[model samples]
Target: MKKPQKAIVTFTNPTVKERLKPHLYSMMIKPWRMIKNTLMLTGAFVWLLLLLVCLYFYSVLSKVPDLEKVPFQHVREVAVESVQSKIESKTKLKEYQWVGIDNVNRDLLYAIVMSEDGQFFSHKGVNWDALISAIGENIKRRELSYGASTISQQVSKNVYMRSNSKSFSRKLSELFTTRELEKHLSKNEILELYLNVAEFGPDIYGVKHASKYYFGKSPADINAAEGAFLAIMLPSPRKYHYSIFQNKHLAPRHQRKLRRIFSDMLYKEYISPNQYQSYLKWNYFFN
Candidate 1:
């Protein structure tokens, strides 16, 4: 009788939904787990990349020479090693020249300050207004051709940066070093450093050397036109200077560019009307 009762036991079938509940939960949770893991990995990679960038920047900044040191303080016959290396590499000259700010003509100094940086004396390290305008100009042109570097920024680039350096990284380094320069050095000191490091001719470096190399005279004795001549060479010394110095002739295009720049210099009060007229007159003599 007990065996017969056991044979009558009923069988119950589970619903399809009930059977799929565990698998469905697993399917839903699987994608969430994968997404969470992917996000964690991406975060780790980003952090590592940022860390590498910081280390690289630190190494570059650490190598920068102290500004209060002997060579910088006393104004030696040659530029700092960083500057010297760049100049020598570019010019094929073994020496990096230097000159005192006192020895540089006011015309040359004013020309540089006005042409390169209109707010040299007023801005701290960066001329934000000029930089913003330059950025706008670059955006409009869709090219990074405009450099809104102040005297302090140029000095920092010459003294602490590589010649081949480019992009936003170069700008960031220049900004940091420029701020440091402005903190420790006066406007006059920054201008002095710029004059000593800037390339004025195809091979000429520093105001003193450029003066003697191109004009066969002292920088202190250069006329307004000569100063303007040197200022215009900054955009591309090789492009402009090779024609004037080697060919003994100024191109008509260069002359036109010079006239446009002179207008800006006059408006900025970098030169007087008389000086402007002198530069205009000097253009014909550039033959």
Candidate 2:
């Protein structure tokens, strides 16, 4: 009876691992759970940020009103410089006259297409092949000397996103604006805007002013040789202008570019073999 009444119960402590099992399991699992949650949150944030960026780009591009009937305007950069030049020289320096694509010479159009963007009529807002080639060349040369800007991109740079500073952001903005422009404007309209806004000299803008200033003629009256000359001078108009006025000769570099333009024009059949030959022998108009 006594044995049955008093089986003195003795409590024994559990082993460390056994006693701490729940706490140890919690400690081990908490960090992993926390990491998983953090990763989830980070992924969500990243996706949200990407969505916001896409929305912003879309909004910006959408705000560009249709260009179907809007009057073309000069590049703000050119306008500013014109004003500055006028102020500094104490004389009128700005000259602009708009001309339709029909008013522009066919030769100049062909020359510009051949010289600047060979695929202007075919390509979209961007020329991926040229861009890739330019990238490879720049990488191999370890310099940023080459660009694959299409006519669309150039118009964007001239009109809305004019910045000489090199950066990825600027390029992206230019592409966006270029796409918008192409979406709203026809090829002929884009070409017209480009021709009308492009700078031909320090203050001369568009084919009208350039034609009168350089040759005392209208844009539609420009000859093949004259058109080629204008297209070649486009790369460095101000420099070539000074050189032509002062020395009556284009530098060797400009001469090379002019030859290249003529060669391209001939290759593309924009000019006949005889015309090409004639241009090859053509003298500089400045002299």
Candidate 3:
């Protein structure tokens, strides 16, 4: 018998080898790749649809202006009572006493602006510098140590959203509401809303009510020292307020820190030197 002839396969061109290699790979991997790509595309599409829905609702909600015609003082009362009850129940603490905002000292408002949000008037809805600084601080601390929320953002959160957890969805909602508020309200309006809605204690909402509950006065009537004290209470209402009230050691330090914030506000030109001096000389006697 003749020797068996051996059949050999070879590519005639280098390009053919390259082409065949890809074909072989496709035969092996195409199904998995296709499934992965299809799943990714589906997820992207779903996210886009959800974003559009949120935007649509936001636009519709923005068109509806706040129509509560009652004086802000009345709103302060309601907020105070509501917050007091909630705090008491949530913490199993004593009943938070209600105090109307009408008795609050006006100087306190200036103090708050000076301390918490010095650039409250100039920024539209966000302070990029503060946000950047806060981000940097968080990075350095390896934890959340600061916040960049503008006064308007805070109002949107305090009034409409629950102050419970910081989830992605809650943050998105806050951004949406803040953008809407910026479009519909002026700076002063936003500040007023914040002053009327912010939490001062376990249940105290708004400076007006907070003044009455803490200092036995209205926000408009608070003096510079009192205002500084109140401003000091803003960073962490639950922790600082209780510490200042109950822990004698913390009270002086807290007051001094508040005064420094006030001075910084003046130095930054957020508050006039005249306003700063007025508060500097005012004796802060709570009660």
lDDT of each: 0.76, 0.75, 0.68
**In TM-score terms, which candidate is top?**
2
- Tell me the TM-score of model 2: 0.78
TM per prediction: 0.74, 0.78, 0.63
1-287 per-residue lDDT for model 3 (tens digits): 89998998875756877879988988879899999999999999999999999897776466433534545455445444445545545532343433333444455666777777778878878888998898899889988767888887787666666565565466666767777677766666667667766777666666666777777765667766677777777778888666775453345577578668777767766567887777665544433
The residue-by-residue lDDT of candidate 2 on 159-209, one tens digit each, is: 665457567667777777787678767788778767766667776667787
Which stretches of candidate 1 lie above 4 Å from their native place? 1-10, 15-20, 63-71, 74-97, 128-146, 268-271, 283-287
Candidate 2 lowest-lDDT run of ten: 83-92
Residue 29 of model 1: what lDDT? 100
Candidate 2 Cα errors over 4 Å, as ranges: 1-7, 13-27, 44-48, 51-94, 137-144, 162-165
Whole-model lDDT, model 3: 0.68
- Order the numbered candidates by lDDT, best leading: 1, 2, 3
Report the number of the highest-lDDT candidate: 1
